[model samples]
Target: MNTKLIAALSVLLVAPAMSATSLDLGYKAYTSDTRDDNAGAYNQPFLKLSHFNKADWGTLFAYVKLENPGEVKDAQHGADGKLTVKSLAIVDKQIGSSNHNLWMQNFLVSNRTVMEDNLYLGLTTNQKFGDLFINAGAGINYSAASFSPTNASFDGLSGAAAVINARYPFALAGLKHSLTVNYEGQFGRDGEHKQTLGYDSYGHQLITTLKTNLTKSVYTKLHLTQFDSWGATPNDGIEYGIAIGMSF
Candidate 1:
């Protein structure tokens, strides 16, 4: 196993003993060849651990993601195909105990040469009608990027972008199914990379997923994701991949 994978697994193993209010463990494999430069296609296997705790207003969340163990081949170009950590605080309110309103703020950092850090703030509205559930949200994202010192085309870059997403979930054949679509567009620049604006400039990701209950505490998931702009630029050719995941 890769060192990153082992480390992620170690965290998951130790998290439950930390007196967590709630904890989730997951493992997945993702493969795709979509990028602006096309030289950065990668096959990534990763692990995730999430912890949630009740807070005064709502919930406190912490997430850890590990990918690309020991510098896998073809992994770069802002993919952040490395170690990443995220922290968020979310508040959700129910309207008459039916509709839901959610607000969250998060910060993320990664050890990546293309892009290293990001911040996100968003709000979402969720509703269920009959057997269908839907969620929509919009947010602001700030991201910073870095490049190698040997061959530099553009210096380090940073920008603020608009992020929007929607998700629809329903049941199919007694299995849980969902489709999520996300869009990001940059309007302002924080660095010299002003050419990074337009439709799908920041990102356009679509994911379809199915989850099957295997046991009370174990479930299997199959998902497909199309990363339209891994570099947040057009003509980057859609990078698509399928992932099989298990969660507990």
Candidate 2:
């Protein structure tokens, strides 16, 4: 990891410690199958740390994943024990007489293997429908190479970006279960940009997760993801994984 990324990660890891009451932390171990043509098909284990916090002003969610944890070199899918960090935050704001449902959202993603940093900024709204909760937003995206040796031609003003996150909770067979869906899409890239990126002008990643609580602090999850015209090379495939985690 670079010095800047390391610094940002340090702040994320310590923020929850500073405000325990508002933060929820969890750890998960999962094995996912990658079906990307260039990345090839491989089953790799990852250890993930997730943190969520809801404050009076807004909310924060972040996660860090250690991919191919046991490998130092030549790991599965060329992971090389890389660390991936993603963080999303919403700042509550109200326009005129409207309720406090309007907000500004920011998302940051950093990956060493791909040597890329992605960021999105836009306005968002929160809504509820019976037992389901949703947060949706649309904005502009900026993507660039984080370091040298990576193609930077596609960097700067990648295109339009949209994000949707929804969750529904219920009790099933006396167990508390929740279903969550998250989507991230990018489009509106010019022809030259698309050609340089080696992907379609539009792309998206949709992930659905079903989580069931085994105990007050323990849970298991099943994850399914669809990658269409996504990634640095625009890999398209379906990936699935199972995970066990504990939240506190």
Cα lDDT, all candidates: 0.45, 0.61
Measured on C-alpha atoms, candidate 1 has an lDDT of 0.45
- Candidate 2 ranges with C-alpha deviation above 4 Å: 1-36, 72-113, 146-153, 190-197
Worst 10 residues of 2 by lDDT: 17-26
The TM-score between candidate 1 and the true structure equals: 0.58
Write model 1 residue lDDT over 1-248, tens digit each, in one string: 12443353334342232224323333343344343345444555555565554432333445665555454433555444554343333333333444444444343434443333444445666656664556555556545444443222232334444444455666677666656555544444443443332223344445565555445445555555555444423335444334444443
Report how far off residue 95 is in candidate 1 (Å): 9.2
Q: Which candidate gets the maximum lDDT versus the true structure?
A: 2
User: Across residues 170-244, which tens digit of lDDT does each residue of candidate 2 receive?
Assistant: 998999999999998888865645665456878899999999989878888888878776655456777777788
Write down the RMSD of candidate 2 (Cα, Å): 5.4
